[model samples]
Target chain A: MKYNYLNGKLTIYLEEELDMNSCKIIRGVIDGYIMKFQPYELVLDLSDVKFMDSSGIGLILGRYNLIRLLDSKMKVINASKNIKRMIELSNINLECVQYE
Target chain B: MNENYIKIESKSRSENIASIRVGITSFLSTINIHFDELMDIKTALSEAVSNAIDHGYGQEDTESIVTVEAWIRDEEKIIIKVIDYGKGIEDIALATTPAYTSKPENEHAGMGFTIMESFMDEVIIDSKINEGTIITLTKTIKKRKSNSKKVE
Candidate 1:
């Protein structure tokens, strides 16, 4: 995972499978950045993610809540077809997610 | 009646999820299964394994073992069972509910069983208070036309 903070926007690049283990690691890293930068806009880039399950959804939702707590907005970009379907199956209102 | 089976036993650690996914998917790839179907199975399997490691062991007892068994029968049916000998679930019905996470503070959305059911054709859950929990996931693959007689 890689992240960049520019102006008030923070973009994170996630790679590989977002399973339980990777989510744990990624969550901590993202949370740290959120606390430090506290950006006005947070973006999650899933272009490099090869596999994702419900755990991935949980990760995104958790981050979304965290971003909201800081009065910031979050957006998910470049999610693959399977990842998008998984998100849809959850039936949760993640209006910020944009599929690729 | 093409058949293949594999059983894996590993510690209930988070890191073992990747290897388990690869092992099960590689075994299924012996035959002709669509990529989407393969991904669906993989996602369901990952959820089961995550439940075993996270909820079953309560994220503290990594020494406990989680066993994953997979079998492909008749070249079109696949069955996977994830077993964990840890603190078993008390209420199966409530646990399977969408977005009902026992650990809300820990960011657990509690969609493990829900995702498994959505991705697989059948999902069976059996748990005892102190014994263990077994999650059986079954899916029927529409065998595509391929020269992979290896399944036979």
Candidate 2:
């Protein structure tokens, strides 16, 4: 995971598989960035992600809730067709997060 | 064609998830299933194996073994079983319910079984408390009227 912060907007590029193991590693790093930057907006870039199971949903929803608690906004961008399909099947009300 | 079987046994480690999925995917690739169909199966298989590693063995017990066995029968039906010898699921109905994770602190959405159920044609779970859990997933490949693999 790589993140860039500019003008109160932070974008993180996610890559590879997002399963239980990778999610654990990612959550820690992202949370660290969130705490340090405290950016008003958080954007998750998923263009490089090749595989994601339900754990990816947890990662997104968890970050959504986390950012919301900090009075920040979060959006998921560039999700692959298959990744979007997995999120749709979950049906978790992620209204706060945007997908593009 | 006769039935083809492949079994993968590995320790319950989170790192092994990728290789296990790749192994199963490679095994199934000998057939003519569509790309999306293969993706669905791979996702379902990942959920089953993740459940075994995360919930079944508690992620800390890497010494235990998780077994994955897949077989293709009748050239169209594929059946896979993910087995783990860790703490079994106490309630089958509740576990399968969407958004029910035992580890809420870990941001677990608890959609493992649900994902498996939706992607695969049928997901049959057999578990015993303090024993283990065996998840059997089955899907029949769609017969294409044309040579193109795209479903739409």
Candidate 3:
């Protein structure tokens, strides 16, 4: 997971399969940054993510909660058709995270 | 038509996960699984394996083996079983429910079973507390096969 900060927004770029291991590392890294920088907006760039299991859903849900606690907004960008379907089936609110 | 089977028993540690997907892909690819279907199976299959490690074994020991088996049934469908001999679920019905995780502190979304059911044609789970758990996943793959290989 690579992250870039621009204009008070943090954009996280995931380029690999987001599984349990990756999720753990990302949580640590992102949480550390959240504690330090406290960005107002977070953009999850899943355009490069080829595969994600249920754990990936957990990552998003967990992050959503964290960001909401900080009064920040979180958006998912460029999720593949596959990831989008999984999120829909989970019954999570479609409007909760934007997929563009 | 072609048929084959693969059985691998490896440690439940996170480090040994790559082979599960690699082996499944190699096997399903031979039978011509569609790209979309293949991607679905890979995600579902990993979720099962991850469940076996997280729930079944409780991540207590790194040596316990999680057994994964796949059978290509006459080139028509693929059957996969992920088994672990560790602590099992007391109530499978509740466990299968969406958003129910035994390990919420770990951020387990509890969508493992849900994802498996969505991607596969069928999913059957059997568990015995303190004994083990077995998750069976089935999916059909035929789009890449030639007309000559069609059966029935």
**How far does residue A47 in candidate 3 sit from its true spot (Å)?**
1.3
Q: Given candidate 3, what's the lDDT at residue A65?
A: 90
Question: Estimated TM-score per prediction?
Answer: 0.94, 0.94, 0.93
Show model 3 residue runs off by greater than 4 Å: A94-96, B145-152
User: In model 2, how large is the Cα lDDT of residue A5?
Assistant: 99
Kindly give the stretch of ten consecutive residues in candidate 2 chain A with the minimal lDDT sum.
A91-100
Scanning candidate 1 chain A in windows of ten residues, the lowest lDDT window is: A83-92
- Give the alpha-carbon lDDT of every model: 0.91, 0.90, 0.85
Clashing pairs in 2: none
lDDT of 1 by residue, B38-60 (tens): 99999999999999998899777
Per-residue C-alpha lDDT of model 3 across residues B24-133, encoded as one tens digit per residue = 88888887566888888898998999988888886767889999999998887899999999999899999999989889999988888889998899999988989999
Q: Which stretches of candidate 2 lie over 4 Å from their true place?
A: A96-100, B143-152
Q: Pick the candidate with the highest DockQ.
A: 2
Give the distance in Å from residue B74's predicted Cα in candidate 3 to where it truly belongs. Answer: 1.3
Candidate 3: residue A28 Cα off by (Å): 0.8
Q: Highest lDDT: which candidate? A: 1
lDDT of 3 by residue, A1-100 (tens): 6889988899888788888867878888878877777899988899998788888888898888999999998888888888888898888764666665
Ranking by lDDT: 1, 2, 3
Itemize residue pairs with steric clashes in candidate 3.
none
What TM-score did chain B of candidate 1 earn? 0.92
lDDT of 1 at A27: 96
